[model samples]
Target: MEKTNVEKLYEWLNEAVMTINMHEDAPYLDNLAMAINVLFYHDTQNLNNDIVKKKLQTALENIQLEQYDKMEKSKAVQLAILTGMKQSTQQQHMMTPETVSLLTGYLASKLMAGHEKIRIFDPVSGTGSLLCTVIDQLQNPVEAYASEVDPTLIQLANGSANLLEKEIEFFHQDSLRPLLLDPVDLVVADLPVGYYPDDVTAAAYHLKSDEGHSYSHHLLIEQSINYVKEAGYLIFVIPNFLFDSDQADKLRGYLLEHAHIIGLLQLPETAFKSKNNAKSILILQKKSEKSKEPKQPLLVNLPSFKNARAMEDIMNQINTWFTGFKQN
Candidate 1:
């Protein structure tokens, strides 16, 4: 098969970034941000060598950024960042898988279909994968906000959003902390799973543990709920063990007080290397006077992405359920 436009674009970016990385030895992901900045600004940054500067200038002259659409641009960004992430020894930066991002985006588009315009936020927007995917998938105008704690990932997110011509406001801080943000109509995130080391911040959350570190995912959920409008929908890619752990009761209690579960569709087992690592798409609506529980939540065991026929059947059923649920 011929290489896609996205692959060609990614190759172009990778070569350009590698040229810079070989000199500066800056982290590879950081080089990607620099490459994008140079491409947009038509100049090099912090590079003293004449040879490298000339190469970057020549590549900038030959580039046609507008030729690629959002899908191509976003995929290229993911590919470049993914390559760098694998080489890094510093942190385990888990990206939301492309299949999972596509599915979650589709769910979000449907969830907010009736609204002509809305605000959306992602508490943990690593590399802008899930949030960007959702923004691209939606049909209406959106006000997008995202926050990230990691400096490298935040740089990559800003660069990618700029390359895609998306107007996003990002806060470079820990999302679990108080954000200077207003409530949003929707929230979509690939929740960070693990213990939150910030005991001071954890102490403020209702989901905080009695002993030791608190579950970061639970605190993020609470934070997201706090920032969503009443009856607003949220879609999260959460670990399968989210509701079955020893702290499960605590999480359940928090949800009951603040939100209503609309659905939980377990992602296909084959999506992950281990079944234990498999995740689910959890759809929630923050509680309010107008919000009512669906007759029965859209519980589903999703088929593998490769099984198109089965996946289509399941989606149709979900669509029908949503139609009725919205009417109720």
Candidate 2:
């Protein structure tokens, strides 16, 4: 397929920013690129090089992207911007495209099987890639929402959603803190993993602490589970050790008591090439008060493949598993 003009323009804008030699000015440059993308998507008539440069400067000065006119495009410009952000030296967090695609496909299938409109959320929605992809892939309509801590990423996320003309509510705050929003149908995220030093919040939840270090990933799981509606799902990409680690016993016990494990797939180590740890996909359904005790969850051991062929096989297996689950 031929690349759209918006995509071509984004390439030029990214290359232009790369030549600027201003590391401290990278955020401004990123904002400039995003604003230019928004402008181009809305008004393609005035997209000459000179005009774009001037408008980008104006946008940077104002620190805003123009509102998008409603027009659906082939590829999301914000995703291109996200790629550029990942390439920049300052980008500290990112999930591989393979992981995102697999999760999106699985979620799309599950949501399509049901008839009701659903609400989906991501607590640590960096760049909004995961949320956007899931929304784009859904066969049925959905209300999408996400929260992020970094203002810059939130700007990029909102800008990308605008360029795609997708309606999504974005929250600029830490997702770890307790939320007062209504419960959602699905919670999906590639959760951040590390030893969180905030003991106060950990103690508040009575989270298990080991060697004076409480894992942030565990905390997120416990917190995210609370946001799901009865019989709703929580899908997360997390390190494999959470399944059997002594430190995670409390979290594991909590999950077993309150939710039904839909499935767990041990992904290829290469699936998260950007990080040094092995990862797994965990799918859990929040149990209804009247529901009976759930059966044991399906556990799949996926073959390790770094390329497209392997990813396809993994996705196929996942789809088949979902199909079987839906049938029963």
Candidate 3:
């Protein structure tokens, strides 16, 4: 699509976001609904005006009727960031499908059985989908910390958190920077892909590319490892392209050295229907004092699905793995 045309879509979506911002109930839903409508209209071959209209009506009806207040400001921000994301291709800053899967899977794994005082942090939180899911799935994350370089996204994330009634500390900074002085028990994040950030700005500190070069993703992995205390677990969703890449190998080695490689799930392509790309989830836990040697990684390649069920199954498996580990 032409940039101008995309801009028009942005205008329409942003207007919807403004409307949502004004609504105290389901603030993000308005923008989301508008986005769906735009997609349906633009989908051409798959266009369904009737379906789109029905969906919009349903969304409108579902939004809780509530008074607007200062608290609903974040929802407005979410709409704005989403508007930027739709056109971020020009900026070479696309949030890939694999990243979303990894974030969702991480939540599923941690929140399955539920717990008290659960602390979660997304060092590279985007629109805060993962964090939002975490808050909604489990009762409440006692403490949630998230950081993103983009001010727009940070605002959106914060807005989503408010809408969901999830308490969180939103940080608008690069995840590569030094983090909390104390470590948390669980860390869930997705490292960005190569190309856009450039080598100088990439945050891969714990990885080495196949050619023996470093990438930004390495930085994210290393920080995650360092930010979690002993017995703490870190789950990362990485691109397949990085698996055999030199940096991928370096990442694997670094993680193995500092932690126990518990499980490696090769995710299906369909896990990310919004975009095309095969991804994998790497589950690492700091070597417990009880164990001396590193254990082999349990690699599981999830089956592909044409619908959301595939994601649900993947989430189930992740939770099961965590449950089985606690039992063992």
Residue ranges of candidate 2 with Cα displaced over 4 Å: 1-7, 15-24, 28-92, 208-213, 244-246, 290-296, 304-320
Candidate 2 lDDT tens digits, 154-244: 7767766765667899888877787757899888888887777777777756454856878878888877878888888888877777767
Each prediction's TM-score versus the true structure = 0.95, 0.77, 0.65
Worst 10 residues of 3 by lDDT: 38-47
Arranged by TM-score with the best first, the candidates are 1, 2, 3
lDDT over C-alpha atoms for residue 147 of model 1:
94
In terms of TM-score, the best-performing candidate is 1
Candidate 3 on 159-232: residue-level lDDT in tens? Answer: 55654456788878777667654687677776676533445444345353434335667777777877887777
What is the lDDT, from 0 to 100, of the residue 131 in candidate 3? 60
Q: For model 2, state the Cα shift of residue 138 in Å.
A: 1.7
The residue-level lDDT of candidate 2 at 105 comes to 53
Per-residue lDDT for 1-328 in model 1, tens only?
Answer: 9988899789888988889877886888888888877766667765677778989988877778878887788888888888988888864376889999988988898899889898999988988888888898899999999999998888888888888888899999999889999999999999988899999989998999999999999999999999999999999999999999989999999899889999999999899879988999999999999898888999999999899999999989989988988788
lDDT of 1: 0.89
After superposing candidate 3 on the true structure, give the runs of residues whose Cα lies further than 4 Å from its correct spot. Answer: 1-84, 90-115, 139-141, 195-213, 273-276, 291-298, 307-323
TM-score, model 1 to reference: 0.95
